[model samples]
Target: MDKVEVVVAHAERATLRVGDVFLKVDADRTRLDAEVEAMSLAPVPTPRILWRKPTVLALAALAGTTLGRLGGPSTGSPAAWAAAGAAMRKLHDAPLPPRQGRAGRSVVALTAELDAECEALVTNGVLPADLVTRNRRVAEAALRPWTPAFTHGDLQIAHVFLDGDEVTGVIDWSEAGQGDALYDLATFTLGHEEHLDDVLAGYGADIDRDVIQAWWSLRSLLAVRWLAEHGFDPFAPGCEVDVLRSRM
Candidate 1:
């Protein structure tokens, strides 16, 4: 029998890889439905779905390695990064899924949430108050409205699979919906700002750098506590903490 390897496990969700089959188990049925539907709607490559039950979805593994991992430099070539960007551009340009929901928060709401989260971080000493405050201020610029586009709400580099310079597949679509396009760009390059140009070149369109930076700060700030609580260390070297510190 093939060994079952845990890819990611958290309170709300878990993913396991057993041989060539990947199993995703989530408590949220809606999210599972969204992932299945999003994969069907995405214009670019996606993992082959084998089957799905109420709480679990099975997918066939894609070829190649993930584009990058958090807390490490991507060994993927610049061309691979560009390919991911181009693929993302294709996704953004695709027609909105029929049942897509608004997946973005208002600037006012986000600002309020940021302030609250920052306060909690400081009060808990989860981060230095100065670091929390600085990133919180930096995140404010992203609160402005954006023209909606179909988005993979979470587009972390690890979700992108590459074979040399080609993007083989993009995974994890539970967060896919109508949202800010820059958010996807921002998420893809999180903690790896040096590769932003390659991605932008492939995107082949003008982008708001300020908004991308703001999202970086916003995302890092919002993720720290949740990550820590989930037994992941956001403050690890070259990870979310470094991303926030780079903004300082």
Candidate 2:
């Protein structure tokens, strides 16, 4: 029998791997259903649904390694990064899903959430006020209006898989929906600024650099407290804290 490996576990959900199958268990069925629906709607490659029962959904693993991790070095070549960008562009150009995604929240609502989270971070002493304030200023650029695209709400580097320079698969689709396209770009390039040019090359458009950078600040600032509370190290070398520091 294959040994079960825990992929990710938190209060909200968990994923377990048994051989080539990944079992996603979630308390929120809506999220899981959305994930299934999004994967079906996405133009990019996704894991095959092996089975599903109640809170657990089984998926056949994809056939490639990831692009990289947040605090680690990227093992993928520039071509691979570009391929990821191209894949993302395709996803963004696809038909909008039925439901709005995480990044699709109204600017007013997002602002209120960000403000509340910022206060909690400062009040809790999770981060220095100056850092928070500075990043908040930087984050303001992303608060304006945007044309909605079919966005993968969480397109972090690790979620993209590559076989050499070919993008084989993209995973974790619960947050996928119509949203600001720039958010996906920023999320992918966060903490890995060196590959921005490579990604932009395959993205094949003249996007606003400022908006992408603004998303980086907003994403890092909003992610810090949740990450810390969730048993993650936001201050790790080359992680979210370092990304914030680089902006100063």
Candidate 3:
């Protein structure tokens, strides 16, 4: 596939070109014609960057706090972690149908996609065949009592920003759709488990720990599948199917 540079760089369906006057998107996914032209002068100049002063400062503070805590490259303070938990609680507990209750989902389809991905990785000498089967079984088990909730979908540290001891913003809204809160929690924990105690404390007692762990397992493996197939080396130490399978 002759991958388009802009498409590859940006995951979103739409984006503004370097010197273009209009926004472009996958025509199948979005109607480019429906979008209006920029309200700029002749050359259409680049889209004005939104001056998120507070947000930027918060992001800087978070970077400092996280780095201080990790003794290395980090994102932000425990404030961002707290904010993420609050955002999650609000999202999961929201009254909206897409976020509130369960959505119709097929375990079979999930399993098949997982298995196919595992098979692909194994074929490319990146995953073990036995571990792939084990992963399939674990995914099936986890799906048995699936309870979906509003999820951050991509709750990595980069999405977190801090202002003093509080979180100011969480950018990247592309994957904001509802799914499983646990899944989001797991991603948060896997990458930033150090703040779990604080995050959970703020989240309160109604949160389901078991469901969160199950979600953590399922979502991580699902993440592994994409990483493996797309040629992204697993970031977790010891990039092996067994490690991901264990999570499952």
Mark the regions of model 3 whose C-alpha exceeds 4 Å error after superposition: 1-80, 97-105, 130-141, 146-148, 206-210, 228-231, 235-248
TM-scores for all predictions = 0.96, 0.98, 0.59
Overall lDDT per candidate, in order of appearance: 0.90, 0.92, 0.47
> Alpha-carbon error at 166 in model 2, in Å?
0.8
Q: Which ten residues in a row have the lowest lDDT in candidate 3?
A: 33-42
Cα lDDT tens digits, model 3, 1-248, are: 33323312233244433322223443333121111111111121122333222112111111222212211244545655666566557656654333221222456766676666767767876656676556555555446555665444566554445556555444333344446566666555653455776677656646666555555445555666566555545644533333455554
The collision pairs in model 3 are 62-76
Error of 2 at 113 (Å): 1.0
Candidate 1, 1-248: lDDT as tens digits: 99999999999999999999999999999999999999999999999999999999999999999867879877788888899999999999999875544346666777888889899989998889888888888888888877778899989999999999998999999999888889899999998888999999999999989889999999999899999999999989988999999988
What is candidate 2's lDDT per residue for 93-174, written digit by digit as tens? 8988998998898999999988998899899998889988998898999999998999989999989988999988898998
Give the Cα-based TM-score of candidate 3 against the true structure: 0.59
lDDT of 2 at 21: 94
| Every model: Cα RMSD to truth | 1.3, 0.8, 9.6
- Candidate 3: how many backbone clashes? 1
Q: Each candidate: how many clashes?
A: 0, 0, 1
Q: What is the lDDT of residue 76 in candidate 2?
A: 82
